[model samples]
Each structure stands twice: as C-alpha cells, then as structure tokens.
Target: RNNQRHSNNDARRPPKTFMPTNGASRTSRKELLDLIGNNPGGHLDESSRFKFETKLRAYANTPNVDPSDVLFAIGSSVYGTNISFPVQEQTNGSKPSDEEEKETNIIIDFDYMKAFMKDVFLSYGVKPVHAETCSEVLIEADRRGIDSHGFGRLKPIYCDRMDQGILWPDKPIDVIKQTDTTALVDGNLGLGLYIGPHCMQMAIDKAKKHGVGFVVVQNSTHYGIAGYYATMATDAGCIGLSGTNARPSIAPTFGVEPMLGTNPLCFGIPSDDDFPFVIDCATSVNQRGKIERYAREGKDTPRGAVIDSDGIERTDTEGILKDMVMGKCALTPLGGAGDAMAGYKGENISLIRIELFIAISLGRGLNCVRTKCISVHHFKSDDEMRSKKKKSSWDIVK
Candidate 1:
C-alpha cells in the first residue's frame, strides 16, 4: 500500500529544470521576480524583496545549480507544497544518478513527525515535558526552513548522545544562583533543547519584574538554534540576546590551531514593521555543520572557508571533516583567512561571548562553567524606545 502511494506521487512530480551555468545577472532579476510573483501574505516588503533577490543571485552562483531553479524551490517552501523546483534529490548521504529520477521521498506530515520524535524521546526515559519541549524545538527548525538543525540532528546528535550517557534525558535543571534581574543555572549535562527554553523563560519572567533580565547556563548539550531563545523574548515584547560557546572548531587570526568555537550570537528586537528585527550568526566564516551538509550532497565546501594543519586552504568535504575531528583543520574566522580581512574582529567577538558568561557567573560565585547566556529587556507601553504603535514578531538567523 505504501509503495503504491509513493508511485502515485512520483508520477505527479514536476520534471526537473535545467540550471544555468553562470550566476544570475541583473538582467535575470525581472524574470526571477515574474516567476515568484508578489510576496504571499505580504511577508516581505520592498526592502526584504530586494534582499531576497540578492540571495537568489548568490544561490544561482553556487556551483552546478540554476538561480531560477533555486527560486522555484523558495516558492515551494513559501506555499507549503512542491512547486516543480529543480532541487537535486538527496537520499541518505548520497546523490543518485540521472537514472534514479523516479525515486521519490516519503513525505511525513508535520504533526506525525513531532509525535514520532516525542515518542522516541519518551522511549529513552525523557520526562514528558522535556520530551515535548525538545520535539517542538527541533520541529520549529524545519518549519522555519532550517533543515540542518531540524529532524536531521534528532537521532545522530540528541538520541545517540542520550544512549551513550553523554546527555541525561530526564535530568533536573538546577538553579545555582538567582536575583531580581539575574540567574545562574546548571543543566546537569542534560539536552540544551530543554534547558534553553527553560532558562530563556526564566529571563523573560525576570524582565517582567525588573526592566531587564539576564540568565547564564552551564553544562548543557547542543541547543537546536540560538534564535529560538531570542524569539521567545521578542514574543514577550522584549529585546532578546543569546549566545553560546562550543567545542573549539574555529581558528583565530594569525593562529593555525583551533582555539575558539563557532560561537553564535543572536538578537531579537520588537518593531512596528511587519516583522521584528532579528539577526543570528556564528563568529566563523561558515559553520562546520554546513560542511557536513555539503559533504552529504557530494559537494565541495566553498574555497577559503577551511584550513588544514599547515595553515593551507582545503576544500575536500570528507577530508576537512576528518581533519577537523583530529584537530588538523579549522574553520576560518568570519572575515576569512587573515588579519587584512578583519578576521581578528570575529575572534574578538567570540572571546567576548565566552567572557560574558564566565565573568558574570564567577562574579556570582557560581562554579558551573560552559558558556550559554540569554538576556531580555522588557519595555513599558510608554517607553521611549518603542518603534511604533504596531506589534508583530518574526525571526531571522544564519
């Protein structure tokens, strides 16, 4: 029965389109705009429309793909259905040959995906609330078009870590210190998926009492996305700031050894516009997870983004991954390979992120260490900083 359903859908799928060899040019903008039509639900205004077009041009320039095809995929994403985009099909970690065009993906409904994930976590001894929290965070990533951190990491990162005893499934998150506007927490080596939301909520609650709140957490595993916590603050009518320090994978300027993490910093600000102002990004030129994704699709990592042990640029996806694990390769700083590009600025930002949590926690006499910080600043109705009378919320992070 399932096989029959798959065959039916495959027959209805649109034929793949041909990709342009060169990047999209200015002359192609009008054609691309015609293909996408007006923004659905007015989700994007003129400024955003211009930005989206710029992004499409960049994607078109990516090796072996057409800009129009990528734009079609974007359209499909917006409408919540397949819209005949010429996206390259991916199965497992391998790309199939041209003869495999008939192959179709098994589409699972969103609710089903969430339920399955919740069940999987429950079976691993996770508390019901914690399991649901983790499931929702992962699903939100997919809903917002961030497949890299979504269900893709459910098994490999979260479940496997739980099985190996690296992440405590139902562990209690403990508070080591607290004040009217500040807090220090310990995650008990639990999943950050659960800990992150809990702490962010605590910060929001504190902001309600005072004008601003700051919370620092320690000993947590990978959180789904930094933007999630920031979004939480914006939803509560407050400005949000969040960042985390991870295992070192990025090298500082003028240094060959990996010394700093790809520490991500995120901000969410309330606005009168259709969408709130949100910015999220890592301090490095590119995240290691992206390299893994490219490797999965049998594509090479972009040039100048990675360096081997001898400080030479490397592009082989598989080799880079191996070398990164062995501490023989490191991601470049945000500006690129050297000081001339101001890569040192990214290095400084990462160090500041680490210091924020460390210095603040130590001042409070908290011994917990492993940096993750969430801070919120609430506003009153008559606050001078309010942008306008309108209220809307949105999130953006890379």
Candidate 2:
C-alpha cells in the first residue's frame, strides 16, 4: 500500500461521478441505513452533510491519491479486493429474497456508507466534527487498500470501545508540553481519528513556521491508517512521517516472547508525479491487522509470518490469532527468523522503544513508532547473542 497511484481494476471502475445517488437496488441508500447499527439518531445533519461533501472532495484531491487511479467503488467487504462495499446481511426467519441473501453481495455506495457510519457515531454522542473525522479517516484506509485498518474497524474497535465506556468521543485533548519543533499530547482516551489529525495539523503548523515539526500522542486508540496523516503533510507540500504501535505481537530475535508490537512506520513525500510517495508498512513480516484480514478471508497466515512459543514457524490463521493474544505466538520482525536474516535489527530501530521513551518522559506510556531497535553493545557475531544468553534486551535509544 505504498503511496503509488497504481491502476485500479477494470471490473471495479469507479463511477464518473461520486455524488451519492440512490440508484443501486441491491443495497439502496435508504435500505443501507437499516444495517448501520440500528442507530436511533439516524440522520446526518445539514452541517455533517456539508462537511462530508467537502471531506469527500478533499479525499479525492489528496496529493497521494489520483482520482483516476482509485477504485472508489463498492464491494462486499469494506476492504474488498474489487473495491466494493460492506453491508451486514440480514437474516431472520424470512425466505431469502434475491436481494436479501443477508446483505451478502450487497454493493453499498461509498458516500452512503460514510454517512451511515457518521450517524452511528453521532447517535453514540460523538461530536459532529469528530464523527465526520472518524468516517473520513476510515474510508481513506479502504480507498488506499490498507483494508486491515479501513472502515472494517468502525464496529469492532470503535463502537465496542465506546460502548464499553473506554473510547471517549468528545474528551478534550491535552497538550502537556510544547517546543518550537515538537509537542507532547494526551488523547484523553478519545477517538484517534480526531486526535491524530489535530496533532498532525499542529505539527504542520509548526513546520510552516520553523521548517520542521514533530508530535507525540498518547492515550489514543486506533487512529485509522497512519499513511493518511502523512499525506496531510504531503498535501501541505511538506514531508510527512508517522508511526504507531499495536498490541504486543512480535518477538525479539532469539526471543519468543511477544514483547514488541507489529509497529508500522509511514512516510509521505510530495512528488511531481500524480501521486506522492506514501510508504507504510509494519515492522513485522505480517502485522496483526493483516493476520486479521487473512482470518476474515479464510486464508492461512503466510509461513514465517509468525512463530509459536516453541519458535516454530506457523501458518494457521486462527491458531496464530489466538496464540498472538495469549502471548503464545509472536510475529516475526521485518527480517525473517534468526540472525541469519538480521531479524535482530527489528524494524530498523524499535519504534516501540521510541514511543516508550516519549511517553515515559511524559509520565505515561504512549504506543506508536517504527524502527529497528538496537543497542550500541558490540557483539562479535550472532554467536555472541546465543552465548550471552543472559544479555539484557537491546536498548532502542542507541
């Protein structure tokens, strides 16, 4: 999912116009709302509608995306391979109508989907602006092919968190410290969709005045795809970089414990080409999100992508997912197994460590980053790592 404007598939060619129309019958816009969480507060206000239209235009015009190169179409899965859409299939005791085969095969309109998601959040009492931001960031993931982080997360990650009273939708973000080129922020357990953009914009503002900007945020939940935030900088004609940590899932080379997250690092650079250079990937051979995707697709995880507690490579998607959470299996770092592939250089510098450093400095633990973490400790060879079994974990500061 690099920031390359690759050609979209011919079968899923985007409609010439994106102004949401109520033409599709399989999943008409009106019927589409029926599946959006039964949200009692079920309508986008005029302000939200206007904002969504503007947001749509903004997304279509992002520097890292080319309208002509995007398949902003519909599909069954939110991150469908064919750029289709997602709608839950309805199944009661009624006979299956040709259309109601349980929203299975439903091709939802993009705008309709976003509006529906927005209303769902609004009903949950999220601020209108935050709701809009949440919808925009998520749809961006689906559009960019970062399916794992796309709109599919709206329910499981967000709705559930908010329902559980953990994800505060309207909490005030706190800026604990600031400097000419850097800042530390606390998300107050609020939506990352809003917090991420807000902090990144702060950085952009700083960069405009000082030629460089950096921001560290903690206490935020999934903020959608990091690439989208980087592109915000690219859109402003500046280089953008971003990273975030996930649930600990990777093992250090020579270690089987999942002490590290499948942290992803994202980079966006403005280019003369139609699309900017947006490179985003997790440090692990496969990230937890991709593994979740594999499970949803009913596919096996790739061999070497993960290892069991015994350190044997595994490919069972279900088993890997279960083991991952239980800390029984660990994702392989960017490099493959063992020092033969230099897996010890995990993601170039343990971004997790950098995140820890920042958050620790702030008196809390913030999670996010991408880099191979290595200590300055000189070692003769891989043999040294094996021989010094009691060696301390490599410090990422170096």
RMSD of each candidate?
Answer: 17.3, 12.3
Scanning candidate 1 in windows of ten residues, the lowest lDDT window is 378-387
TM-score of each: 0.67, 0.67
The numbered model that scores best in lDDT is: 1
C-alpha positional error of residue 29 in candidate 2 after TM-score superposition, expressed in Å = 14
- lDDT tens readout by residue for model 1, 1-398: 00112346564765444545554544454465554455332212455546565555555555655423434344333322223335565767566765564343334445666776787677677889988999999888776766667765676688667757887788888888888998777787888888889988999998988988987776677887778878898888889987776767888887878877787888999888877788878889888767866765569999889987798989899999888889999999888878888988888787665533443433321112345666482110101121223222211010
Number of backbone clashes in candidate 1: 0
> Compared to the true structure, candidate 1 yields what TM-score?
0.67
lDDT of each: 0.67, 0.61
| Model 2 agreement with the true structure over 1-398: per-residue lDDT tens digits | 11222335522644333233223422333333343235343222444334333433444343333222222321222212232123333476455586444222323446766776687678778899988988889878876667787666666678767767767788888888889877767777778778788888888888888888877665666777778788888888888877665666778787788777666667888999999998877778887778888876679998888988897999999988888778899888878778888887774455543445433333333332221110100000000011212222333232
Error of 1 at 57 (Å): 41
